[model samples]
Target: MGTADTFIKNRLDERKASGIYRMLKPENSLVDFCSNDYLGFARSAMLKNNIVAEMAHYPDSLNGSTGSRLLSGNLKYAEELEQQIAIFHEAEAGLLFNSGYDANVGLFSSLPQKGHAIICDELIHASIIDGARLSHANRYTFRHNDLESLEGKLKQAKGNCYVVIESVYSMDGDTPPILGILQLTERYNANLIVDEAHAVGLYPAGLISELGLQNRIFARIVTFGKALGCHGAVVLGSNLLREYLINFARSFVYTTAASFHQLASVKMAYELLKEVDDEANVLRNYIFLFKQKLNNNSQYKLLPSDSAIQCIVVNSNGNAKHVSGQLQAAGLDVRAILSPTVATGTERIRICMHSFNTLEQVKLLTSTLNTITHAQ
Candidate 1:
């Protein structure tokens, strides 16, 4: 092999030996327990039909955006959809990005300037961390969900301090005390940016809006891929902030705009979200059932969360992988979150409960988990 190939193979071999190698698996027919489709909109026949119908309204639309937004790809319909979404979420304005990763990366990287501060929760998403890394700002991370820790970081911040956090943490599936965090940010005069990727469809317009804090937050990132079951994301803030990102955020400025059909899907998803309060309730019920099955059982260590994303810590790479494998073998779809995605001893099987998951399915998942973890 060539020298580069040798180096690549050695690095991959190290990952394999360390039990952290990754591979993409084909879709299977197992019971759903490991997807971000909290509201089942991704799998909804109604949603599919609505999107198809909506696309029919724009018969001459392009199959794909010809170029980036600044080039030949900007569409009037895209901006209209952005306004509709922003208004629905009670924001002054909004700007769309291709996906949640793009939104977070674009917002975090471009907003904070040199000598400014970007303070994030230690458990913030990898995209945010990467975005912060690309910025010229001084970066710091507080202990996850710790108000005191965040306050300490805020005090150390310099110019144009921005505090970043997720409304629903992906791995832990828990929410920070948002009000407390917001109060601290206000006191410190820091800009609070919340990523509501996992909380969007489940909470009407997301946690900030649900709490009537839409006008209070500096900026909010709402993703469509998770509960909304669509393909893009939007950053909601002031009209000035939207304009700033359009000019300064490289991810949004350089990437091709989303296609007509993708935009149609997003629009359709939001309409469906308005009608799915019942489904949202069903999702909450399933979450409760899953937690009840565990019942603080000493055998399984389930993290505390009210969100659809639930984690059961198994404490090692080997244990987490084995438990996840056993779960998949039992006709349940579950995946392991191994280090260094999480800390070494905090590796877990991340269980995602959806509105369409039946009661029997939840029972089987918890029972199977009990059996496997007890066997350990």
Candidate 2:
């Protein structure tokens, strides 16, 4: 057999030995407590119509971008979308990437230099970790959301320091102290990069803007796939940073540009998010109620979070997977986040909430979970 086949077989054997082999399943329409479409914009008819309407004004808005963006794929629509995103997020400029993963890799690998140090949270997204690994910078991981620990690491940094974190952590669904992080960044004369993938479109107005920390950070990565109900992500930063990424970020420079349809859809999604105040309010209420219900139930251990994502620690990967499977068999869509994905002893079931999920579904899912766990 070929080298590629042997490599795949070896990897599969390793995973099987570790009891961590994973396989994909067909999409199911069970009550969603797992999708990232927080605002229900993925299925929004109005948003779809708006994209179609925009595309009708330009017939070339379909199909793949012909070549890499550095080549023939550059288009007027991309620039327009980036401008809209930058304005909306209150950044000096925004550069779009194919996905959040691309944005992370592009930013992390390209921003820090050989003499710089990258201090990241131990629990940051895998993409960020991978990017940091690819970077030439010296890297260290502080305790998750522990500013003091990060500060200690900062003191030991040898050169230019970059502090990286997510606004809302994907697995844990908790937020770090933004003001404190910014303070540390300034104190150490370091650059701060925030990945707002889970917070954008769900946070009030502009998340970074709402905190009034727009001008203080080096970059903010806002993703459209999660709460925005679209594909792609944007790295928001200074005009200089945008230009730098255009030239040096391999992920952005080498990949084909996003299609015109995707750009139009992202623009439409942002517009809808801006106008749909009532829907946003409803989502906020649902989140509050969900948290209240989880808190009131003393039987299960819910991670501390105020966002749409929540986790229940089950400790063992096998147990967590079994619990998740039980919930799925009962027609709910909760997912088990296994070890290796998380720390071995910290594996849990991750539940993602959506604005469109009804109160009845939330109540039923909670009750079922309570019963399953024998929670009082």
Candidate 3:
């Protein structure tokens, strides 16, 4: 009907030509190596039962959040849950968001003043990148996990500065040198924000708590959908930050408050995390096993990470897809991380290990992968 239609179609065609086009497929019934259900809570019937038990405790809780938190959507006991979350994480206060993306959008979109600066790692999540893009502050991206590069950018920062990074990067699964970066940010008089999306339940209290550096940094973003096995996220900071975001963060101000069911699910998930405190160690065992098996394979160039997400670079989108397809055919549901998502040369087959995954399953997955590499 218009030039806009033709332009949009051309962009779609370009994606196809570039070997980066994507579409959602039905959930694979293969082995459990592709999901973010790091602890198998998504597949746990006990969690669902716990949700029902939790809902029973809140008779007055509504079927749906009627409006934004500013209006009718504020449910009884919601603030109590927020406080519980804060206490659990050893933070002064907590504010909930519908999802990690919404939280990032709200936080960065609102925080940076006109003369302030937001410096983020280049490989930080797209949500943070989008949020920084929306801000009026001078934004800069340092090389991923390169503290020296971060300092270089910080040297040119104008006003109040915020340094953003993930505790555990989602793509490569490697953790940044958090203490070193924290020292750098402190030296520069900058606030540090850590996205603990993948490291929430993986550490003792968190990476911060495990490092014995609680309340030293500015804020920690914790998401429940991954390790906690539920939906929603929270910003852990001071009460003043909570009040400020409630007032100014557009995503929080304009969106409907999280439903009681979602909030209760978060609560119950934490209860499960505490009840099964040894699960993190169990996950570490799998990571160790996978790495140990891949040892001495001179041709295998898997990324160095101590986390559940293990990536093997395939160099090209075509090759990554082909290898992933071979694995999937062997009954593993691994996925390929393509270019545009990652750099062209760093395209990979991302194998996500879970706590519930069996030792035999891990063995089979590695064996299949090793077979593929040998064929290549």
Candidate 4:
């Protein structure tokens, strides 16, 4: 085999040895417990039918976007929907990207110009971390959700500083004190940017919009694939930032645009979100019920979070995977998030609650978890 083949084989072997080898499994009919579809819109046949019907408005024989949006791919209907989205989210303007990762890459890589500084949380998403690395700006990380640490970093930052954080942290499922952070950003003279990927459908629009801080933020990244149960994301901000990103964000500028059907899916998803706003409460209630079942079981630590993403800290790659396997055997779909996706000692079984999940499912899941953790 070639040298490249040997190198790839060695890397794969290392992952296996460390008990962190990743593989894709076919979709199963297991009970719902590990998906980010907090609103269950992905399973709504009604939403699919509506989206299909909406596609009739576009020109016939269209299988894909002809080119990038800057080229032949920009559909008038799609741009109209972008405006609709911005209005719904209470932002002055919005720009769609092919995916959440693409949006993060485009926004961060392009926004922070040379001589500017980016202060980010230590526990921010991997995509955001990669985005920061791509920027020309100096970057500093404060302790996750620690206001004092962030304040110190803010004070030390140079020129046109930006504070980047997620409205709801992904892995841990905790949220920062956003109002306090906003105050510090104002005091330190830094612009605030939030990734509300996990907070959007749960909150009326997102945390910024929920708090009526739409005018206070520099930018916000909202995704459709999670609670919205569709694909793509948008950067919500002022008209100027939208225009600037369109001109300079290479991820959006150079890549082929998302197909007409995909954009329609995003539009339809938000429309559905508006109709089923009460599902957010259902999901939160399930989260509460699941935690209540745990009831201070000293088996393993359950992370403190009011959101749908609940994590049981198992603290080792092998153990986490084993617990996840046991839950899967019991027809539950709980997933193990191992390190180096997270910190070394924070390997965990990630339980994602959904609006469709019944109270019985939550009880069974927590009971099974209690048993497995006891066996450990």
Best by lDDT: 1
> What is the C-alpha lDDT profile of model 3 across 113-209, one tens digit per residue?
8999999999999999998889999999999889889999999999999999998889999999999999999999999999999877667457887
Clashes of each: 0, 0, 0, 0
For model 1 the local lDDT of residue 262 reads 91
Cα lDDT tens digits, model 1, 1-376, are: 9999999999999999997999998999999899999999998999999999998988998899999999999999999999999999999999999998999899988989899999999999999999999999999999999998998888889999999989999999999999999999999999899999988867968989999988889999998888988899999999999999999999999999999999999999999988988998999898888888776667558898999999988888888889999999999999999999999889999999999999999999988887786335
Q: lDDT score, residue 206, model 4?
A: 82
> Each candidate: what lDDT?
0.92, 0.86, 0.89, 0.88
What residue runs in model 2 are displaced by over 4 Å at the alpha carbon? 1-7, 204-206, 295-299, 374-376
Total clashing pairs in model 4: 0
RMSD of each candidate relative to the true structure:
1.1, 2.1, 1.4, 1.3
RMSD of 2: 2.1
**Model 4 per-residue lDDT tens digits across residues 8-97:** 999999999887889998899999788888888888897899898888876573788989999988888778888999999888999999
TM-score of 2: 0.95
lDDT for model 2 comes to 0.86
| Per-model TM-score on C-alpha atoms | 0.98, 0.95, 0.97, 0.97
The 10 consecutive residues of candidate 4 with the worst lDDT sum are 367-376
Clashing pairs in 4: none
